[model samples]
Target chain A: MACMNEDGQWIVLMGLLTALGLFFLALIINQSALVGQTTAEGVLEFPKNDIRDLRSEIFDVYDSYGTLHAQGRLGDVEEDIIRISLERKNAVVHFGNDTPQDVSGRDLHPVTIHYNNGVTEYDEIVYY
Target chain B: MVNDSGQLYTMEGVAAGVIMLLTAYIVISTTSIYTPGDTHIPDMQLEQLGSDVLAMMDTPDREGGTSQLVGFVKNGTETCGGNDLRNEFLTNCKMRAGDEDTKLRAQVYLSYRRTDGTVNTTPLSLPDPEFTGRENAVRVTRWVQLDGILPGIPDIEHSSRPRAVLVEVLLWRA
Candidate 1:
């Protein structure tokens, strides 16, 4: 009877400890689910405005291609894009327009644009 | 001393109460709830799609002819012919890489500086009937530098000089 008296107390303590451990484990699992979902959600929310603004600036340079290239100002614009991308956006960007080629009856310049922002990378060879 | 036989039952009751309290608190606190409106992910996706469609339409397939977007802006009048712009926008937006269709609607507006050097907005596309003042919409804008006067709708009397007009399209999904 003396052994039984203290033995049941130990059993109740052990059961309580196990219950607490399971509760903690469940909490950890609940939080881990959120971590994965937020990561994928962030990727889905792409920096679309940034890409659009970059494309617009590139085309703006293209629009003034003749004067800017002749004045060597195009080099400065390109350098600005690369430098700012590295400093502010944490991206590496490079774009170039090849010699004009005939595509479907129009003399269009083939522009190759490469953009990588660590998380996402986009490459395009669009005719403009 | 009195027999402590009921002490074990009292301890059991306390233990069960503590466990129940803890589980109730944890369950209430950790109920992970999510709503689509809480996250701006859908809005971001729709905005990106709208901007991409506008950019593509602005780009001329060839060098000489006017871009579809520019032509639409130049020829557009108040309350007329915006249907074409809306239709063309939907046509491009609905075409996905996997040929999936998205249900989206848009209202287009043009922002320009008048001769008095003030900005003005004129509607190019009418809003849909479903736009009952509560739908969430995103506005996508593009700059279109017009070389000549906007042909129709003499509300502000624009000059023949080059005007940099902004094409703002308010897009929403049904």
Candidate 2:
């Protein structure tokens, strides 16, 4: 067979180059979108507000500990906290305030709080 | 006419190229990936920290005593006690396992109701000097229930009655 006239060979080469360039550009854009999405998702996933709320509630209980203990309702309140956290929030939660320890000339009680949802776990020993 | 059979192949190639370019452009533009350094996450974190600090200050460490937050609101003058509030807020917010400073600044405002039922806001703390009026500040508020009207604040007919007041804090990193 005789060789055909190759008049438009440059068009095909240009088309391939354009396609490759576009492919790379798309890849880079895809990676950038993933970066933003993961950052927002990670922030949303971490239970910051839950941990803060739990800490405040624990401190409130600590504040009222003497009165609640005198009235024998401390255990009830503690049970309520744990049960509600487990049932509603899907987190196992427990906290207890130890005897008031003198730190820097101030009586501050050492409180230990534990929290665990399926996704994240937080434990802290805060002086209230 | 060059009796061109290659014209059809060239046309096909042009169409394919146009289609691929359009697809890539649309895909890239439609995703619209925003810059990750936007204000949302930091605002959320600052607001959360401000609220946590406020709530902590409102909690009394022992029974039968008023919370420090309540006392500050009830007795604070327009210019005084802001230092204490600022110091305490910074102390609580910056306290971590390590002693690294978080470099946060806050200004407190109190919202109360007049006797004719108009809500008023009064500044309890001043914003820092570094606040150049363009910072990304977050406002966090808390409801403080008082047994009696705040003593220092004037122009309220129900000063002797129980009231619920809102304490707002504008927080930013200086």
Q: Best candidate, DockQ-wise?
A: 1
Tens digits of lDDT, candidate 1, A1-115:
5535454565676687678767766875566456435654675546566566667757766887886777665665566565555544567989999999999999999988888
Candidate 2: clashing pairs of residues = none
Clashing pairs in 1: none
Give TM-score values for chain A, per-prediction.
Answer: 0.68, 0.84
- Superposed Cα deviation of residue A79, candidate 2 (Å): 33
**lDDT (Cα, tens digit) per residue for candidate 2, span A50-95:** 6776676667666667767786767655665565566445789888
DockQ of every candidate structure: 0.06, 0.05
- Give candidate 1 regions above 4 Å deviation: A1-51, A54-128, B1-38, B78-80, B97-102
Give the true-contact fraction for every prediction, in order. 0.01, 0.04
lDDT of 2 by residue, B33-74 (tens): 666644467777777777778888887789767888877777
Query: On residues B41-147, what C-alpha lDDT tens digit does candidate 1 reach at each position?
Result: 66767888888888888888897666888787777763335667887888888887774566577888776655444456788776677777577787776766455
Cα shift from native, residue A61, model 1 (Å) = 7.9
Minimal lDDT window, size 10, model 1 chain A: A1-10
Candidate whose TM-score is highest: 1
